[model samples]
Target: MTAPAPSEKALVPFVSVENMMRLVHHIGIERVLTELTDVIEADFRRWELFDKTPRVASHSREGVIELMPTSDGEIYSFKYVNGHPKNMAEGLQTVTAFGLLADVSTGYPVLLTEMTLLTALRTAATSAMAARHLAPKGATTMAMIGNGAQAEFQALAMKAVLGITHVRLFDIDPKATEKTRRNLEGSGLTVMACETSQAAIEGAQIITTCTADKQYATILTDNMVGAGVHINAIGGDCPGKTELHRDILSRAETFVEYPPQTRIEGEIQQMAPDYPVTELWQVVTGQAAGRRDEKQITLFDSVGFAIEDFSALRYVRDRVRGTAFFQSVDLIADPDDPRDLFGMLQRAKD
Candidate 1:
């Protein structure tokens, strides 16, 4: 019997976590942060150009897993992220993520990358992007409420985008704070470890809350907040997880990435339906105002939108090409005969 001919396959690029780190290293984290901020801001300004959706989440006894999908008419991107607050005790990150970028025209994946690190980068970039328009002018000091893997990225992005030179850190775990400080060394920012949340926020122009708790924990109380402060609330990004007191949200002029999603996931989740919040895209596009007065309290309730990940994948795809590090894998099969779906089974059996 004649052997079956070799099957044809389409080559797709696969980027591992190590390759992604090398790519970021080669491009320089500061440059990547700047470029990602630009990409996300541009995407936000033209918000009507893309297809958007809230992430689909699967809940388990331990935590939750989520799939966030979005498309820009040309490129499609989605991220798979799991939030297991218990994972840290197992020597794992509280969140582990991966994502794909595909050609919308062909419905074929062009790149697959580990998003664990990318998530941290884009989250920080998004926060800084929002702060650029919402934070007070000449903001110099920032308070980081939670020191985890994301803490250093927030510090770097704020320093690069907002000219923040002083970072005050606080975390439930002293080791987490130490890790943040060590990672931020030589970044030209002064790092201070604070004893409590209030100590961290004292005299800070921008306050970022990126805790990993999966419940309603008030990391920032209304009393601790002062006037003219921009709050980047990043941790309370799901239902049942809230960092700011309801009164703090009621008192401040709040801005969010996507109002509908933020209503369910951000600190505003604790507020009434008509609590009155501004969309960050509107502020970026100049369709609405940001920080109306110098003394007005501004809050950016960030839930990590799909558009930001879309922009991040696009940026990485553009930069990783022509580099020697990426490997090609066949994630999808391309049969020469489109009707040969059953043939795949026969070949496997043979």
Candidate 2:
């Protein structure tokens, strides 16, 4: 028997991270990650169809803030995130974020989500998705530099996407490394604690950097990297924060999420104006070559693009519909008469 659909007058649900977490947990992390990758890849292949722009950024003495916006004619989305590295010491998240999805036809918001957790998930998913194409075949071991909030997501994504079984971990703070290890205790992967970045990258086929600092700091030097290592540079996403040495970028073939934004935010920002690089979407769409040779060193210069958040928002919206958890507030005024904009105010007086 077919059930009747709910009418438009039916109240909509609003979801928080706690509610969304149940959805995520029930679906399993790998499945969610796979779906997100599929959506992002599909969107990237039709890059010309999107209304894209560089994110709007506001700078402060403590940190930098940003709003990443994008649309595909039907749905428009934006994420508000702040990058304050010093916040952790004060017991706050280094990067706290939230986002919205709107209907372009009317500029009506359809979904609102706390992106703090989703950002970590999507960032890791995007990295693994890019690595699927750019990294060398049969890549197993990964060295995670800068263990923090993003460390577990990175480890889980690599394990789910690339079949990684061994992870070498390192961070300036010992507690952070311990926390990462604790988070992945039952995730079915071997975790090794390393003393230095050199030891961490020691035979690792994949290297992920996710440090939270607001300066041009080089965590990985040219000498530490070996042939066929896929470097996922996630921390050096802003102008001043960098993980790889400039000389390392000189020797390796680098791929970026979006060329223009990455040019200003990725590690390549340290390089010359004409430094050659390929966009990951090109490789995803088979328009460019990836890992040309087994001996070639590759880097994925990640700057947390808007398209990723778009994908994440879409996923959350679809999953939350009819779930009775999401609460929808009246953000738009719908008057009975098209020309009665002033009538809405008069009704409140009654």
lDDT per residue (tens digit) for residues 1-350 in model 2: 33233234222345677877787787898787777777777887877778879999998888879999999999999999998888989999889898998889978678888889889889989988988997888988999999999999998888888889999999999988999988889989999999998899988999999997888887988888888889999984688778888988988999988889998888988888789999888888899998898999999999989999998998888877767657765545665665975775566556
Count backbone overlaps in model 2: 5
Q: Give the clashing pairs for model 1.
A: none
Report every candidate's CA lDDT: 0.88, 0.85
After superposition, candidate 2 runs with Cα above 4 Å error: 1-13
Give a tens-digit lDDT track for model 1, residues 217-299: 98888899988899898885778899889888888999988888999988888888998988889999999999888899999
Q: Could you list the CA RMSD of all candidates, in the order they appear?
A: 2.3, 4.2
Top candidate, metric TM-score: 1
Shift in Å, residue 157, candidate 1: 0.5
For candidate 1, give the lDDT of residue 8: 32
Candidate 1, residue 77: Cα displacement in angstroms equals 1.4
TM-score, candidate 2, is: 0.94
Residue pairs with clashing backbones, model 2: 13-326, 13-327, 14-326, 14-327, 15-326
Candidate 2 lDDT score relative to the true structure: 0.85
Models 1 onward score TM values of: 0.94, 0.94
